[model samples]
Target: MKKLLLSILSIISLNVFAQPDVKFNITSDWGTGYCANINITPDQGYDDWEMVIKAPGGINSLWGANSVPIGGGEYKITPSPWKIPIATPFEIGFCGGGSSSDIEIISQSFTPTVTEVISEEIWIGENSSAYLNTGKEYYMVGINKDEPEASLHVGTNTSATSTSIVIETEGSDNAEINFQSGTGVSELNFQNGDLSDISSLTFSKNDNGATMSFYDKINSEEVIKVVDGSLYSREVVVQTDAFPDYVFSSDYNLASLSEVEASIDSLGHLPGVPAAEQVEEEGMSLSQITTIQMEKIEELTLYLIQQQKEIEALKKELNNLKK
Candidate 1:
């Protein structure tokens, strides 16, 4: 009877030890490198465990465990010396350069031994926060419902209330990229990966969403070059309904052609319909400027049509006189 009871107990232990649950997910991919998160849960409490993975390409870096290559595209990952409770899930992660699709877990081994367990500490609270130091870069990424959300940071650090760039999303359709500072105070400088100078852009936003604006500091030569480089194959149909009634209203001032030419002579550029500087000073947005420019272009087209008609009528009268 005693021998039979011991046999039954051993079989129950073996059954519990055989259950191993592991889940692996690729979190983010940036063409060359990718990040993955994994979770492991064993039915029986274990002092430690080892997981082996095979991938089409080599593993570059791993975190949350000690990993060593055992050759032949296999990496052995051992959890740090700590006991994991039965059926409790623990997470590990790695960032590697590989065929992101061709990763598989080949084997996992668990040692069910009683040992002192050290609890892992997580720093972030319900409201996440990170401390940024000057001259350093930080990247934070996570997966929610099989979608990746990420944020990148690089700049001189200041108080939490000061100017900074923040890009964030809520794992949904909405995303916001903000370059925040006092009104009209901050500028974003762009550069190539080789650190060569590109152009600078500025952004301003007020409490009203309509007041948001973007300004580019490219010189007139660069502007001309950009326009020359553009492709314009599509037919343009200017819809009169798109223009606001204010543009045609009697109260609005339309400068004479000579006045426009004089303004261009003084400013060294074709003046905006209401003066670009004045529009900017009044906090008009780029979209607002574009709308006003389109209206002026359509109005100029009408003036050209009227002049062509007058020229054709005068040519017909001159021919009749010659006849």
Candidate 2:
């Protein structure tokens, strides 16, 4: 976040005075909310101080002080009397409602006093975990000199238990992401390549699950890659009862050989084969076309089985006639 300081003027016995230094820092930021700390140091002693700040978003919650909206993105933040000491530094912290690019100190007011000069310093704790709200987005970035490794963890609580999704880079050349729901787990991985160049990862929830997408600077494209079967355990179950026999019946209207030939001639590929024109004109993805092709394969298999049965019956009748 960027900070801007305003010029301050003080009048003492008809003499002009310069204002003290004030600094602001945004300690934590979530998508919709953030926390910030402010420090004020005046050249002279004062009994009470009021600081005005112009923030991008309105203030939602504030602590270590009292504040009231004054209009036009400005808030009058006055520290309690007991909190400030004469000729001492004062600090205050607040959490805001919306995301902002920067915060600026617009103005200040304090009771001036004449006293011996004294140096003072005040420190405020950083709020690192302020951004860790459930169902909110957060990110972490780091660099390691010894070995390259980075990870992101997003967790949300449900009733008494919590669910978390983790994405991390393993060793020098592999990255993996996993989702945990009680005891069940699903993972996707990339092998033999480094993801160190990735600047950030964004995740959003959808009806089915969450979707993660990243931009590839080298390729100059936005890539969304989904990997299935990254982990290795499986079971198989065969359901013979569910097999379809409709392709053997006349009502099925299986595609004729001539129709298939014509399709190949006109489209330069079989029907349901992925084509650039089909995707561009019909707005179907390659994966969707591939699924259609698989269905066609199943239909063709049933037609071939029906033909084989007819051929076997003809041969048996011919043998009977010969005998």
Candidate 3:
């Protein structure tokens, strides 16, 4: 696309250079017709400048000049009779019927030499810029660029080390790009200032119902993700109030195996653990679950120690009876 636009500008410039006296600039062009400014630079000290215009539909209206039908889809154009000699090189504004593509300057009579004009197209070259306006909003094509793709297209291949584009907003205001749809809208925002005086980046998906995931490039699998407002990761670490090591204390209450069995029978779950229905309804916290599991393991260890002591005491009593 860059090459194509450059080629087009080159063609327009070459055509203008073909006739050196006239510099044509298209002012505005609608589909059916166009208006233009034709800059005529005549030879030095010659103010009586006239040119022959050849168009498919012919010239309908002309200003800053006089026109006479010279036949063969052409108009013999000269300065208006009352229009005094203002400058050596002057400009003429004209409106013609049909597309600007069919208009051209066949000859001129500043000194019997001819010149040419332009078609309704963007003119981009060295030191030249063009803009297009569909309605009230204006769209510019080039800014310090030989050829540009369109509005908002920035940067080029160069050796200079500098940022291509920079955008700044007022203090305490967020600069955001809004993504809108029929159902809802999402925004990627750069929150700049607040009471905390810190900057942050935020992405809100609204109710788009799409999850964001991060993948491991080497493993080619998702390692972290967000789904339905929750975060998931392959590994996690949680901080809790305390661990189950306190169960080993001498004053700790240890339940007997029969007591634990009775509680399970009556409660339909472990004594200190949440029931399945409860966990399903109001999800489980990782820190709470970890502490509970460790506590159950410690209780089981205590039960094993008590049973070993009973077995030892019974063995001594049986030995005494044998004696």
| Cα TM-score per model | 0.32, 0.29, 0.37
lDDT of 2 by residue, 64-149 (tens): 78998999888998877677644566668888877656567788876553221111111222532122212215323223222114
Top-down TM-score ranking? 3, 1, 2
**Given candidate 3, what's the lDDT at residue 179?**
51
**Each prediction's whole-model lDDT (CA):** 0.61, 0.59, 0.67
Model 3 Cα lDDT, one tens digit per residue, 1-323: 11124547566554433422678877988968888888876443232557888866766678888888888888888878665432366789888788988888898755221111132333454535353332325433455553445555565567677777766678998877555555433422222224232222223353656666555544456666677878889799889989999999999988887888999999999999999999999999999999999999998888888889999999999999999
Clashes of each: 0, 0, 0
TM-score leader: 3
Please tell me which predicted candidate would have the highest lDDT against the true structure. 3
The residue-by-residue lDDT of candidate 1 on 86-134, one tens digit each, is 3367788888886778778898887653221111111333345433222
- Looking at model 2, which ten-residue stretch has the lowest summed lDDT? 115-124
Q: What is the alpha-carbon lDDT for the whole of candidate 2?
A: 0.59
